[model samples]
Target: MAWDLSVDLIKATVQLEQPVGDGSRTVGTGFLISDPTPGGKPRTILVTAAHVFEKMPAMSAKIGYRVQGKDGVWRFDPTTLKIRDGDHPLWVKHPTRDVAAMEVEAPPEFVKAAIPINYLAQDDTFNRYNLGPGDEMMALGFPRGLSANPAGFPILRAGRVASYPLAPATSFPTFLMDFSVFPGNSGGPVFMAEGARRRPGSNQTQEVQFVAGLLTQQVELSGERLEIGIVTHAKFIRETLALLDKLPGATVTQAKAGKTVKGDPPMPPATPAVAISATAMAASR
Candidate 1:
């Protein structure tokens, strides 16, 4: 089933890890979204989480990017890619969107190897495929630092959406799901369904175009009993890309010259009539 899809699709999946302040590493999964600013040049824009990028105890972590390679392909030396400027988001000085874009110098051979990302907000047809409770999902990542066996890709663990609209009612665009999310699965793509049986030569079943959500946080349980996972809705990813377009030096256009207008962090406009009022309804005693 993995062989059927082109590299462009799989290249969007990523493994994200960074060094924390205490000399430990914090890992998760994330994927790339190809929302080029007017021009079509490549940009290293990715969607993960605000908490994921923000360092624990208020210090940010060093960001790292990983790509898929052949079973025998040795991992590229870290020096092969250079992150422009300081690695911390605060240094970049853009509003904390919980997402960040980087300018990296990738090796020549790795230039054209990434998959283009997609979004549900592109059309009504795409949004209709958004996931809800009881739907199937597959968390693809290197959980527990376990590398692939003989396969070139990481392991894919199957799961389901534990809840609907992962964010609070006030935050309509965001959603969450319950999966067995682990240490390394953050920023990974949580696919709708995997390997649905198909006949040898058919239309290929639409290629599951609805990549409805992204794996973000895993609810840590106290004991051996399994609990749930959390996913950020794909819509936030779309919004992040739109915001990136507004930033300076994003594309060929000259950045507007002046101090950036700063205020509260930017967020998507609230959904209509979705407010939660504590006093509108009478208490049932």
Candidate 2:
């Protein structure tokens, strides 16, 4: 069966938010990936921009999940996800990129919704698919903290590649997309779903679909909105996921009175403990 990225990603993507203590909440986007352990134990990893977790000061954040009723209505069913312990972040980040990944215990339904790890583009995916400047791509995000509806599904948007030299992730870690980026759009996945595209140097066409990257930031100058988003290549995301295995016991360093100290490895906290009060939800708008 052919893969449909647009539909598959919508099921995997989710809204991540945390209360800012004041009236508003910090919002961002994230997607689920099915990356099993070496022993074949089922695992789910949440992938997002590192800055999303960095901006949330609280120890836990709400992951907006939705469920469809038998009556064909979708309802938002958010749950608290612990992102930090004390002052240390639980998610693993790429050494030199904006990508972040963390093991998550999602609902069984969501675990099935996760995209396979093979769907993420590698360093050679671009060349294999003949993807370059001007190629059309789609993105998913909760722009301005608003969902497609009250159900909390992310809004899907499309854009064209705006920059050149889309290869060799080492030399160019990020590329530009011609899209209107917003405050809550960070960490969303950017992907290409071409049913038929000519090969790099051949006349025959082939179906190509894969996640290209993650929207890390928007291009701006002099505080002006440029309608351009910077996307960190998916290669970095693959690398960050590997970090989870390499540093399973990694500790985050903390600064104590001008001195640096290594803290213990982060552990998952209790489930659904941090609830976003109904009053806080109304104030965020």
Candidate 3:
């Protein structure tokens, strides 16, 4: 297994934490992305599941990013990412998807390791690879709010792509995998890396990596865990960002420092027509 490939993938992964007044925290996973502009500065978007924000709602939630300290060791640093600084909605939720993207002017520390937009799987890449069941895949995320190291690197879990009709991605836009996902795994990146291939019309070889989708939730049945994970396809992610790009750009409105922001929670978007809950749907053996 090319586990080393995770070095690049985890760099873009961010830990979403909402600290409560009772010294507890709500945790989830998110990643950073840079979408290129024709002639302007590329916009930095924070990608995560919409349900993440709704869990223990807060106005100004903090995102955890790792950086090396003077001791030459990585340490976690919390940055206040304002979701709603006063009356402004800092986050953009996909109209009907379980996705949300925010146009954030993150500091160099956070943006330096973001995943490039081109890593997203395009239609051609899917067709060329003939992606379907049995294809190897990896999920980089913080399951149960647990990271790999003090640097806050995500835990890399391997599984196989288990779905159909991946080529023409259906309008509902989702897939499934066999990883036993925990509650906190939502919004993590699902990817395949450096698959060796012959160059076009030549015998030369090259390596290609692509992000496929995200771990949204787990399917449970009657107090039992199914070990099947629901993956929200990458197409919806691209769609969410595209929807954001069409709007006018605006400067970030920061709230006063040290003040814990608060706001009413937003409603969770509707689930896909095919309910994959353990009770609603069974795992394909």
What C-alpha lDDT values do all the predictions have? 0.43, 0.78, 0.68
- Each candidate structure's TM-score, on Cα atoms with residue i matched to residue i, is 0.61, 0.86, 0.81
Candidate 3 displacement at residue 62 in angstroms: 1.4
In model 3, the clashing pairs are none
**Weakest 10 consecutive residues, lDDT, candidate 2?**
276-285
Every candidate's CA RMSD: 12.1, 9.2, 6.9
Ordered by lDDT, highest first, the candidates read 2, 3, 1
Instruction: Kindly list the per-residue Cα lDDT of model 1 for residues 1-285, writing each as its tens digit.
Output: 554322443444444444433434555444555444568767555455555454323332222233336665533121111222254343222253334444333333333444345533332422344435676666566554343442224556766666544433225443445555455655566555435533236644433545555555555444432446565555555655666666676432111112111331111111111221101111110
Q: Lowest summed lDDT over 10 consecutive residues: which window, candidate 1?
A: 276-285
Deviation from native of the Cα of residue 21 in model 1, angstroms: 6.9
The 10-residue segment of model 3 with minimum total lDDT is 269-278
lDDT of 3 by residue, 203-250 (tens): 776665788877777767676777887777788788888877666865
Superposed by TM-score, candidate 1 places the C-alpha of residue 120 at a distance from the truth, in angstroms, of 4.8
Error of 2 at 223 (Å): 1.2
Q: Report how far residue 73 has shifted in candidate 3, in Å.
A: 2.0
Stretches of candidate 1 off by over 4 Å are: 1-10, 20-23, 56-111, 119-127, 149-152, 164-171, 193-207, 220-226, 251-285
